[model samples]
Target chain A: MKLEDATPIIQLGEHLLVSMQGDLDDRAVLQLESDITRSVSETQATGVLLELSGLTIIDSFIARVIARLAGMIRLLGAEVVVVGIQPAVAITLLELGIGMQHLRTALNAADGMALLHEIRE
Target chain B: MVLAIESPESVCSIDSEASLVTVRARVRATAVDLGFGIVDQTKLVTAASELARNVLRYAQRGRMIIEELDNGDRRGVRVTFEDSGPGIADVELALRDGYTTGDSLGIGLPGAKRLVDELTIDSRPGQGTTVVITAWDS
Candidate 1:
């Protein structure tokens, strides 16, 4: 499935922003990784901001895919930041033993963009 | 003496990726009906997602049963997943973190265990597997 059909990838001044809303099935999650990675390289973005406030749950599979996406974007020379993790999801992720230390994160979209800019500098 | 009351059980078939989403929604609705708090609801839904996916991944297809429980003082939700696939060879290893035979992160079983109040697994090498998880209102 095309990335646009699942989630839109918008370009914002050298950074690409993708907002994930609602429940995304396993196929969509995997598609997002490949789509985002390609968009980063094609756009030559300096950073990528993933907005995840609309996601109610992040299972192990989703978490692993997100982490892997971050690593892939970094290899393409762009930093990735995840923002808008709910308090409960954060607690559950920790309990699930997925710290996601390799990825940078912020509380919301504004903060995430700012962090991305700081990292790009 | 506290009497236990159970609501009518609902079952969802897990035969495709879309079924995974359906199961999570069903569990979330049941959790809400049981008066589970936000955190508890999220934990239960997340655990349901993991186990449902396991059914699709290992057995190729399975079914999940959701039921509401009340013991006069406490309310809870229980989800049971059953699949007729190649059963787990090592239940203990399967429940450990970072142990997987497929192309997954290997945290589904153990992680689901950590998210709820109770998790039980019954599997035979060649017969099938059954996993049940329960989370009480907190």
Candidate 2:
């Protein structure tokens, strides 16, 4: 289907909190790529917090986009921290060859926000 | 010890996954089950997904065959996706990355070939297209 509605929420503080909502599939991934790239470029926050708690499935195309987004944020001199990755999403990411290495991942949004707070510290 | 399983039986025929956001997640399960390693899973899955999507979009309907070979310690998987639609008019341009017949980044065919061990494409202007992919563990 549409995979998921790509409404990237940006909460500006010392960092940016972007929560993704949708099924992370090939059909809707490219658009997310464009949106994330635009959001990061437009708002040069210290770090970007991506909350995937709303996601149900994490396809490979979406996985690649996640990897690329982390890399892109690094290129822009900002760090990317992921939060609320569902257990299913986590399993899929691992299976798809996505390493949690070099990327910061938290169990829930609260932890992610805390990590962001720590990073700002 | 080469085990040969004919077409249609070898491929993973899943539809909705093509459109799922976490499509890559299924790649490792499919690849490992097909006898590939965790390291090779991503490349194979991505490559296979590209070809599978092509079949769905271009051919409207088709079947994929994923043949895995495991003989005397050698392990690998071969994928053959066949479509009965109008075949490629220009295989050369189609193989070039970013050259898409549809709205993709056009990294489907060429990228798939590059990600694997062996690739053989058989297609004609009106007949159809057959993509044969083989990944070997060395």
Candidate 3:
């Protein structure tokens, strides 16, 4: 099978922006580790913003990865925020208890950015 | 190197989707015996439970296929699950983490694929879904 790709983007700002595309498969998860590590390191962002609008599902394994990512970002003196999570996706994440620790979620990008701004002050 | 290992006992032929977590515990521990970590085992078991539960909930009945790699090159397991349910409307949309026909959290396939090294999904609207998952420890 062809390995799933990770569509991650990094920008310089108060919030580190990263988006994941394609299936969040094991390979993709592994790739995300390196991508996040690099992106979080080079950016001056104090918070991490995740856009899950493109993601339609939320498996437990992926939730674990997200939890781990959140922990990793916190170690860098930053926090993680999730956006565009559908109701069903949110339910699954809740079941897996993925983001119970210091996770801030938003209904849209605007809300996510606003939350970031709120945290900055 | 063809590492083909099969366990007939690992097959859980239940139709209750709500009982999935119980089965997950059973299967994950078995998979762990085959050289998987606690985290990896939990992921695989959870993924399997979600997939199998879909079968029970949507299709009402199905079979779970479990296979492990004996290849000297690597240590892994493959599970091919088949269900004769109402079928998926849109595979791409369904592949998304939140798109669900039922009231589930809609993370079964997406989450399952993420937990394993390899994932293959084939389904039709009325035919059913055949999901193949591969987990590796190598």
Candidate 4:
């Protein structure tokens, strides 16, 4: 499936919300990193909500991509918040030693949006 | 070629990014069939993803084998990843978190180890690498 179809970027007010659903391969995740970065720059968004509740697994490679994507978004002057990480996925990530210490996360999309707005304000 | 298993419960070829997804799905399904809990299933699938990607990144191509194990009252799943790419020069260093020979976080091997109950790696420079991991249902 196409990257855009699997994970679409929606503009919400001054922010971009991407709900990543289904199975995303390595290439798709990499494509998403670039897509989100470019979208942030083009739209001049103030914040980004990356919803990952649809994803069942987040391995090391995907975790690295998320971290890098967050950093890139911040460089573009946009706040990014990851939302809806499944409990099992979170446990696996911690066990894998990927704490994602620098990235901001929320329990769900609504809370993530609030967190992003808080950061912007 | 790596040592061949007489019969693996399932086998998935690792040749591209798509194959990584396939391997994860296959492993997850096998885990479910073997009655692995949600947490255990997620851990096994994630580890399979990391290892499958490693095969593509380093070896260019490889294969994954899933086997169902029965030990008296216990049931488990075993996954083996084999690649004919340039083997790891320092297996010890490779297992260390944040030590990547490539442009990565360098936690695939070690992280995969932590997810499963047991993990072992065999590699020979200029030869190939084989990693085996097992998780038991408790």
Candidate number achieving the greatest TM-score relative to the actual structure:
1
Kindly report, for each predicted structure in the order presented, the TM-score of its chain A compared with the true chain A.
0.93, 0.81, 0.82, 0.95
TM-score of each: 0.94, 0.58, 0.53, 0.93
Cα error, candidate 1, residue A5 (Å): 7.8
The regions of model 3 sitting more than 4 angstroms off are: A1-98, A101-121
Ranking by DockQ: 4, 1, 2, 3
lDDT of 1: 0.89
| Residue pairs that clash (backbone atoms under 3 angstroms), model 3 | A56-B96, A56-B97, A56-B98, A57-B96, A57-B97, A57-B98, A58-B97, A59-B111, B3-B70, B3-B71
Task: Note the residue pairs that clash in candidate 4.
Answer: none
Q: What clash count goes with each model?
A: 0, 16, 10, 0
Better of 1 and 3 by TM-score: 1
lDDT of 1 by residue, B59-112 (tens): 999999887777677988778999999999999999999999998989999999
Candidate 4 lDDT, B4-84, residue by residue in tens: 223644878999888987898898888898799989999999998988989999999999988888776778888999999
Question: How does each model score on lDDT?
Answer: 0.89, 0.68, 0.69, 0.88
Error of 2 at A33 (Å): 6.6
Better of 2 and 4 by lDDT: 4
Please, what are the lDDT tens digits per residue for candidate 1 over residues A42-95? 999999999998889999988988988988988998988999999989988998
Instruction: Tell me the tens digit of each residue's lDDT in model 2 across B26-94.
Output: 444557676665446656666666677777778776666656677757777777778787999888888
lDDT of 3 at A86: 62
Tens-digit per-residue lDDT, B1-138, candidate 3: 867777777676656633454456556666777887655665666667667767776888877767777678767878877888878777788778777787665677676666667778788878887878887874
- Model 2 error, position A76 (Å): 15
Estimate the TM-score for candidate 1: 0.94
